[model samples]
Target: MPAFPNSCFQISVLLLGLAAGPGLLGCARVVSATTSAAAADCLVYVGTNVASEQENTIYLYRLQAATGTLTRLDAQPGGAAPTYLTMDAARRHLYAVSETQTFRGAASGGVSAFAVDKKTGHLTLLNQQPSGGGAPCYISLDRSEKNVLVANYVGGNVSLLPVQADGRLAPAASVHQHEGRGPHPNQTSPHAHCILPDPSNQFAFAVDLGTDNVYGYRLNAKEHQLAPAAAPAFTAAPGAGPRHLTFHPDGRYAYLINELNSTITALQYQDRQYEKGPAAFTELQTVSMLPAGFTGPNSCADVHVSPDGRFVYGSNRGHNSLAVFAINPGDGRLTLVQHVSTQGQTPRNFALDPSGQLLLVANQNSNNIFTYRVDQGTGKLTPTGHSVEVPSPMFLQVVSDFTR
Candidate 1:
């Protein structure tokens, strides 16, 4: 990716002038300028904690690209405590998971779908379906957009829900119950925390914090089922508590962020052998996310690789900071760059905008979302001094559209 130039403000001013000058500019030129500006803006959706007395809601906000300022848009009622949010590939539908054990008398959590209004950034409820488990914490769409995968922490399972023709969710097609335990007290049962599809779209991996394993599966799209891969799972350290996994853009490496141990493990991925054999991942290195001399309790929340694949970032909840690492392009190894404070209590989640120019961190306990400017060349984060107040912001999803 090209380095982020310093002339973004100047370019924005020029575009504004062209958009405002109808008499001097041609009609086509004015329309083009206006469309460009609209494309630069984005819509941010936040998932919040749900309380019994409080109605669960998914808050929407408008993000001004030029300044990284956020304006409250709307709060749409949703199922009980939507803790995680995801969007379809076309950006036409938004999905969120209600992280409760029971939903409307059923002994399962709920997943709801909504139609996204591109122009207003509003959401219209499409339909809701049972997630086939309790305390669903993460959701992801398959590459084909035909199925939604969910991981249930308390239920100790992973499930697949079919996506209907109209973008609504169909009843769950399959649920895989996990069994076993790890070394820690919280690891007494299988607690699947995240499920993400491999870049090849042929397989998906479920990160189980309780079992300390990342289970691989073959996505049977036709039946909307998940079958265990030949090599079913990769074992992390006995008490590492693998919470999330991210693959390198080049498809040569994979990273797992351990929530309990506060460390990241890099693995070498082999794609070619997957055709005739099971997918293979070999451990390369493990690095701590916390800074030296930090003895306080800390757990990791999220991890992401930069768009350019040159940097990796992981959120440290108790430490309240983001650990930055530089990736070795040739070897896929990581070296710690720096650890920057998140300026909040618990950064449960953070998202890098589509432009790769700004990052928004959702500090759950602090009830705020903080924005930071991404230094493209150095992979460093500088606070934008722009933040918005939200109640228990657990996750953030940003979408951009030029047609708006």
Candidate 2:
């Protein structure tokens, strides 16, 4: 009998959930966080997606901050393709987008709300409301937590949904449509990928991948509405599909990940109240998220700044790595720090724990999640040598209990 090729062997091991050597393939197992004397308890919520309409569930796990171990806690029935999730500031509620084109007989997706059970880390379905668009891909809470903003990838629009007092979602109070296109083949129409408020909470920005535009809006928290800003849009380079945006904690800088071009653009933000609007943004520098000379198909997914605002991290899908960069304190420029393997395939999303000591990555295609220990002085990630197996884990949200 002929021996299997190395690539085939690795694929077979991954599919069979067999143990494999380090740096080659991840082993499958049901592991949880164990308690240690110095452990801080953290609740991790993972959203999953599958190819079909088969009901997928959102999983809850208990994370031991000291050990970086994850133990399964509970599972809630998340509707079809709950691909993205966001938690409120109080950690009392969780919101996720059911990424489907049809919802309750309407040609729109849905956003579901869940009440977080503090004791058991369980989630109870609060309610779900029509997201006012089709294929809602991203969801986020405004700075004031009074409204939820959703980006519709297929509908080419963004919507603001009012949050009820009981942590439920109301119908969209305002919907804004994006119009334009980019040079990429995927940019045949507008695709609003993500929307969130700036650090000042006075202006919200929507990154549209299909249009290569970052649109700004005046956030009216009182009325739970969004209006176009004076500086309505900042256009990125043509064919550079901006997927997500993250602001520096200092509120002086913003980072955008371009999915089509595999690059990150750093911009300086001004929050001075002008007569027309309250914010302005100017591009500082654009940097590549991949190493030189290794040309492979890659798409950038998520971009996030460390809690201390000293580092920036972005996810690479085809490259299956996390690119880390150090922020220059003087000018808010980025210096490449490291590119570490995500230990699995297609790391579509990741999150940094509140303490900033741990980073969790969701390997969407490999059906697993991995943890890394972060170095504070240098923005480097060291694998914790720990992983947990879940089916099609697409997003991760960590709610930390630092008091523990």
Can you write out model 2's per-residue Cα lDDT over 1-404, one digit (the tens) per residue? 12111110000000011122344322232222321112234678899998775678999887776667888978878987898898876568889999999999999999999887655667788999999889999888887789999999999999999999999999999998888898899999999999987765666789999999888776777799888754444678999999998888777788889999999999887555322343356788999999887599999999888877799999999999999999998988999999999999999889887657678999999999999988777879999988999999988877654212
- Candidate 2 local lDDT, residue 162: 94
- Taking every candidate in turn, the Cα RMSD to the unseen true structure, in Å, is 8.8, 12.4
* Model 1 TM-score on a 0 to 1 scale: 0.89
TM-score of every model versus the real structure: 0.89, 0.88
lDDT of model 1 at residue 107?
85
lDDT of 1: 0.79
Q: How would you encode candidate 1's per-residue C-alpha lDDT over 1-404 as one tens digit per residue?
A: 11111110000000000111333212111111122322245678899994654468899887666667888989978668888988875568889999989977898898999998755668899989989999999998887789989999999999999999999999999898888999998899999999987776667789999998888777766789887754445789999999988887777888889999999999887555554444357788999999999999999989888766789889999999999999999898999998999999999899876656668899999899988877777788889899999989988887663224
lDDT of 2 at 304: 88
Runs in model 2 lying further than 4 Å from the true structure: 1-39, 273-279, 402-404
Query: Model 2 clash tally?
Result: 4
Error of 1 at 195 (Å): 0.4
lDDT of 1 at 236: 92
TM-score winner: 1
Q: How far is candidate 2 from the true structure (C-alpha RMSD, Å)?
A: 12.4
